[model samples]
Target: MTSQGLSPSDIASVVDALRELRVRSLQSRRRINNPPRLPSRKALGAVVEELAAALFPHRLGADELDDEGIDFFVGYTLDKCFRVLEQQVRRELQFSAEQAGSPVDGIDERAENIVRAFVSRLPDIRVLLDSDIVAAYEGDPAALSVDEVLVCYPGISATLYHRIAHQLHRLGAPLTARVIAEIAHSNTGIDIHPGAQIGPSFFIDHGTGVVIGETAVIGQRVRLYQAVTLGAKRFPADENGVLIKGNARHPIVEDDVVIYAGATILGRITIGAGSTIGGNVWLTRSVPANSHVSQAQTRSEIFDGGAGI
Candidate 1:
């Protein structure tokens, strides 16, 4: 106001008037007492990336990383990670407890226990990811080397994140686990929920537009090509017609199943073990083990799609 040439007294009066007006307006307030907050998800993701890189130094962009170097790096990073993650987890849990009108007395202890459980399972998770890489290498004929698969393949990277995040999810750290998994999904076109239960030797070939819904159970040695969707058809609503969450509505791909390109398998139906689902097929029913499903030809067309008829 002074810059605009208003007098000092006039400016002060204007400010007081505005303040009084705001106070009066608050008399009709609809909501109140929202606190200033920090985004826990964003913070958790940043910490997770740091921890992941430390856990897998060479694979995650450490040029000078060796076997001995990796151990030191992991140890150092875990110390820092535990501090930050534990603080954030405790804070988030306290916030949730407060919001639910519950006591936050033991949130600190619970958060520590959760972090310890998650970090302790990292070794097993890494082993599972290695198996996934081996599975991808053995399944794909075009893959030249294991290094190529590990370095360039988005699917493997995403699978690694999924494995780690899934353990956190099982430990009941949903928000932190989701942030880690979504970080992978954003980099890779594969969106697998951390809550999904995936077995060993899972391979995703040319993974793009791959969506594995929450509650989906994928069995061992399952190979899925691009644009495959193992998802639910619809959500069941509650009595008030609002959709419920945490339902087991996704498909279950059994052991040794092969779903080819552009196949969409919807609902909670099970695709039996050793079944081969052909390309560009839509399936809702359960396919028996060792069954091959392909589109039936009604007329002898030119097969202009350039696929095997």
Candidate 2:
């Protein structure tokens, strides 16, 4: 206030305006009391990183540790991650219950059970991640090694977050899942919804501007390049002009399909198995299996030097 040369009355006026705005916001939006606070994004991000480290201990975790020490470190990291995640899951469930006006009795046991099931799925997630790393290394000519893909690729990072977040979304913690996915989105420009069902060995090259919608289904060994979108073509509206929810809107990309950069495949159409979509192609309809789609050929013309401008 001193630096800006604002008087006491000016400050009071601004505060009063802000208070009125806050009141208006409360009246317009849903209201709650004593709502359980979800875990911070930073904390959830740390949990994901710790889990990644535990999964690839020697590569991403403490490389200095010996065989026995590596096992111990992994165990410790897993336990710590699980404990923190359980607490967050509990808070999420409690918040949901409060929002629904449901009783929260025995929510602790339910959260613990959910977390235990989630923890048990870590090995399977690791196996899937291994396939993803291999796919990235194999698909990219510039990739030197699997370790390089795991450690350096933005696509791998986003996929890692998606895999973890997808599990959480399936287990009834979509808000937490979305937070985890957004962490990856902020770090890398890839925006993949946690509700998207993606198969193993999915690889994205130069991942900036890639968007996968919530209803998108991707099969195994699918590779996509930069600026590729699997999006909804249109939103169905009701009589009141409100957009309908839960429709199958995004594309289904089948196995072994390679979609090149700047391709937009929209709506519920299926890109059939073993198809190749060329760069900058705008596609909407479903294609047969093994189809090859590319932009229409363009003709170039040469102008004479004496041509009028």
Candidate 3:
């Protein structure tokens, strides 16, 4: 206030208006006391970084570290990361329970269990991420090496967030998992849902504007280019006009399928194995195995600034 020479009464009036809005928002949700807060995205970002470093100690971790130093750094980082993660888990559990009108009597136990299960899946997740990294390197000729792909690719970063978020989604911390996924999305422009089931050796090249929906199931060795979407064509609503949830609404991409840039495959259809979907194609039906789908060939025409075509 002093820097800008603003009056204290002006600040107080603004705060009063904000509080009125907050109260109205809480009442609209029918929230009881609004439970204090949920997990913080900033905190989860730090946790993911620590987890990434733990998984790839040499690449994501400290570069100066030797083998023994690597081990120590991983151990220390994970210990720190887990503590914060567990607290976030507790917050999410508490918030969910409150929303459901349930008591948070055993949130601590549930949070600990979720974290324990998440920890158990780390090695497997790392193995899956390695497959993705290798796939990106081998699939792209411009890629110099797997290490470069791991360090440089947006797909790698997005999938790493996916790998962690997917596990957490399965482990019952979906809100936290979704927050982590959105962090990657906001940074990389690849919006892969935490609930999506992506298989091993998935490669997304030039992965900007990609959207894989919640119920999308991608198979092994699938490759996708920028601006591809596996989305739901329609929403099924109930009698009260509320959209039904948890249905398999997105596309099921089969093994070795390649979806190119600007392709939009919608509905609960299957893209068969070894198929190649060309750029800017809008598809809604299921295709057979080894099928090739593309947009219709356009006529060559020149359009002047006027009405000429």
Candidate 4:
């Protein structure tokens, strides 16, 4: 074997195979780009970081900054972050237009509008996130301070990304929103679909293995623990035997509901307000408000010398 890697002929053969695989997978009429020109993940990550720091300037921003410096940092960071976000959103729109064989006219103006709408909603997002931070702080006894919850809690981290993603989803950048959601999921093991409508004051504790599916409607003051799955029990397919999209399959968790860890609530069931679901419960049907559902008690029998053989 030659130095540096595989021989040129072997490399050529592998490249040809990869090309064929790409063509087969994409099945698009458009020519394949070796690296598809999509939204930049790195750029989006940076934008999220900038947004986080901007939202909590004193805490997440650079250390040892005065009030004026904090203001300047927020202004500068938002300007730069929004510009990058616009570019990324433009890329998504461009890719979609090209894929649909549509005109790219007015794409720039549309991207600008979407970004502006997103920017306008920042205050509301921050408000929602503040509620989440407070919820996390109050819900966990071990949590020392609200600042600790804001800075260190995985649930709050996931909620921040989800809140950002939800705004982007509403602003017509679903692809970018999904990417941001996935970034949080990858980091925190919390899968929250951007399409899912979650209300304020939501708290997720020990947030690992939490899955909230698309179309899931979550109400305010809802608390969920680790390994909780609000997922679909079955798939409703089209006449062509293809799975139908956008069906309301996930659960609707009402306000003040507390779902414990390892609880799997499936289907389009309505979990009424103020309900408490015990750990490791596999629930399918709906439960009314103020209800507490738990697994059945285990019955044990001991056989002694006098007992039946």
Q: Write down the TM-score of every candidate.
A: 0.82, 0.87, 0.92, 0.89
Candidate 4 local lDDT, 272-307, one digit each (tens):
999999898878778889988885410111123343
Which of the two, 2 or 4, has more TM-score? 4
Cα distance off (Å), candidate 3, residue 240: 0.2
**lDDT against true structure, model 1:** 0.81
Per-residue alpha-carbon lDDT of model 2 for 172-193, expressed as tens digits? Answer: 8888899999999999999999
Candidate lDDT scores, in order, read: 0.81, 0.89, 0.91, 0.90
Q: For residues 1-309, could you state the per-residue lDDT of candidate 1 as single tens digits?
A: 346687899999999999777766655552135442333767777786776676567877457877777778878888888888887767667666766779879888998998898888878877787789899999889899877898788888789878878887898677677877888888898999999999998899999898999999999989999999898988899999999999889999999999999888888899988999888787766777898888542112214456222
State the RMSD for candidate 4: 5.9
Candidate 3, residues 178-244, lDDT tens digits: the string is: 9999999998999999999999999999999999999999999999999999999999999999999
For model 3, what is the alpha-carbon lDDT of residue 105? 99
Better of 1 and 2 by lDDT: 2
Q: In terms of TM-score, how similar is model 1 to the real structure?
A: 0.82
- Give the 10-residue window scoring lowest on summed lDDT in candidate 1: 295-304
Clashing pairs in 3: none
Best by lDDT: 3
